[model samples]
Target: MKVAMWSGPRNLSTAMMYSFAQRADFAVLDEPFYGPYLRLTGLDHPMRSEVLGDRRKDAIEVEQSLMDPVPDGKPHAYHKHMCQHMIDGIPRSFMAECVNVFLIRHPARVVASFAKGYPDLTADDIGFDAQAELFDHVRSLGQTPVVIDSADIRDDPEGMLRGLCETIGLEFDPAMLSWPVGPKPYDGVWAPHWYTSLHATTGFAGPEGPLPDLNGHLAELVARTMPAYRALETKKISQSMKL
Candidate 1:
């Protein structure tokens, strides 16, 4: 199984990756696009190198490389990509084999975290619009992509994770709950805010402060993304009714 999990910023994406990695049969790859996006856009992100280090190849080179083909014959390969939007001028077929999951958080929470992590950025600067684009793009690909809510995952990890495994045709594994908590190599370069849950287990629980309240900016983002987010929710509910 080639699995690709997508999520907005500040979601428990990294922890979810850790969950999958706990399975002895699965090999995981953290955001392959982190490097390519930074290198391609030349954005001066705080953890620029950390995100893109493993993929420091030129952007055009990446475009060319992806155009070739994804190799077949891999089993239990889980690739986690924090995708907000599709890269322009790249082939969607490049990722045809992936079983897609979209992990989402409330915009209020997402914006609050963004504010804390980036002093210079406002909610306007964050790519909320890109998220809808991702929703539409993924919907166009598969019949039923698993859309899991981050809050639900955090609140009831066992049930949500068990259902997630069943949806993806994997046997439920309780071991995912107790994965060693710490930053692994594939973790985002800026692991502080993003990897907070992981670092908490390593004697750094002080950073697990209250979730910041949403400000005007985050409110705006929620309004913008609500339609797409609700659509995904409705789809999930409808699927569950049939099952």
Candidate 2:
């Protein structure tokens, strides 16, 4: 099965990618469209040139590759995708061939965490709107996509993952709980800029502390993103499990 795990920046998307990568049957692809996103938006992110230089700058090419057979004959392909990367002109037909999953984090936490690295963040940058759109689009096709919050996964990795596997018709693998503390061969070229904190961990970190105080544009961005976040939250898989 091809699983497209969609999330915005500063979420546990990378950690989830790591978890899935630990499974021997899964071949993981990290942010295959990130380069095209940067090129399309002209966002001057850290290592922008390097990102655009390393990965294909065509969204259609990336989508075609994603729909192709899983490399090395792996049974499953887990593609870590940023929701905001699905810009205008990118065809959504390929989504029908994949088991789509949305990975969300609280808007306040997402804004606070994302702002540290990207001070000029906007509502579009957080991806709440895009995620909701994707969720609805997939649902319109009569497919109930899975939605998993970062907190839920961190709080109970095994239980949440088991539920996720069952929902997607895959057997749960115990190996998804942890991985070696370092970058993987599949990480995007922009990892050095965004994966420093993730590289220092072997498993999901504990719950975060209080949300940071926001003001000005950051606070406004959070407000703008909350409605979309709430829309997706309604479909989030409950993390209540006795493990």
Best by lDDT: 2
State how far residue 97 of model 1 sits from its true place (Å). 1.0
Best by TM-score: 2
lDDT of 1 by residue, 127-154 (tens): 4455556667767876467778776666
Q: Model 2, which residues run further than 4 Å from truth?
A: 241-243
Query: In candidate 1, which residue ranges exceed 4 Å CA deviation?
Result: 49-53, 58-74, 122-128, 202-212, 237-243
lDDT of 2 by residue, 1-243 (tens): 999999999999999999999999999999888887887788999898888889855888888898888999998999998899898866677889999999999999999888888888888888999999999999998999889888888777888889889888888998998899887788888888899889989988876777778888888888889899898888888876322
* Candidate 2 residue pairs that clash: none
Please give the lDDT score at residue 94 for candidate 1: 47
lDDT score, candidate 2: 0.88
Q: What is the TM-score of each candidate against the true structure?
A: 0.79, 0.96
